[model samples]
Target: MSDLTPDRTADPTGSAGVESKGGDRAQYGMCAGLAGLGVLLLVDAARLAPVQSSNDALGPKPVPIVLGVLLLVVALFYAIDIWRGGVGAAEEGEDVDLSAGSDFKTVGLLVVVFGVGAALIAPLGWVIAGSLLFWGCAFALGNRHHIRGLAIGVAISLITFYAFAIGLGVNLPAGILDGIL
Candidate 1:
């Protein structure tokens, strides 16, 4: 629409364009891919050695096997629906901003924030690094309440870190808090 804006007339999935073959194929392909993943999971689970002292008749393989069958069934149903001219419903989430063009600056900032968080995680720990990541993203997204944003970020990150570490037994890097937390 502007002199500086690249002519997006050829961008098949751009705001200027309509229903694209690439997008349609990708949607169906992803459904097939999900089904493939489920099959792979089930196959791999089947290859696992059975528990010697198993009291439960239904072992680990049953869950993955059931998941695989469900995925396959869903994929088939979705394919049939698509073939019958059925279209997926649009997302009604608050994040929808169809009118706005791509905000490259915000995207770039977020990328940098995430990259920095990854680098810092091993040294600073999940709590600290994740907090910074959250705070950086809030600022990048135009949230001006710096203190409130950082506070929320720190709280959420710390909560998630402990949840994964203590509740789920996942070992997130503790770094400086290694001995303490």
Candidate 2:
């Protein structure tokens, strides 16, 4: 059989050494998860029996359909990558660490932060909850600028709150700030 090993010093696809499989698994996993989520969304959309609710402009179909289509596109790309033997340019013999200690820590912190933020957002209101999310993320990501980070986080939270809550007129739970917002 012809050697499957790509030359180490040479570009694999003849492109300018543009890609690596370093995070291909992660990307694939994300895509798979998204595709699964899309399937769920599509199912839910199908099950959506129209009912009279306070909010009745756009039915449940729109968001779910949009999400499903987008997710399907992402899934297609990921599957293509897998079919192409991943995005790795390294030779067949070359080895790399797909999982690292820092990666675990980062992923763990992200899960915790998202879980806590989602749980707290309703009870704490957007501003406070968002501030917590922002500051917590900066800390988790090993940001060094303590005050600056916090400031930036708070600013982001406020801006996001204003844009989504105020500008878009989307109804987000006020939680603690129910009367405050």
Give the alpha-carbon lDDT of every model. 0.78, 0.75
**Candidate 1 TM-score to native:** 0.67
Q: Scored by Cα lDDT, where does model 2 land?
A: 0.75
Q: What are the per-residue Cα lDDT tens digits for candidate 2 across 1-181?
A: 4765445566545333334433335457777898999899888888988866777767667888899888888888777776554664544543767453357888889889989998898888877888888888888889878888778877987788778877988876667777766
- Model 2 scores a TM of 0.50
- How many clashes does each candidate structure show, in the order listed? 0, 0
Expressed as tens digits, the lDDT of each residue in 8-87 for candidate 1 is: 54643343322432334545886789789878977988897786666766667778888888888888887765554455
Candidate 2 regions off by >4 Å? Answer: 1-44, 51-58, 63-123, 175-178
Model 2: how far residue 71 lies from native, Å: 7.0
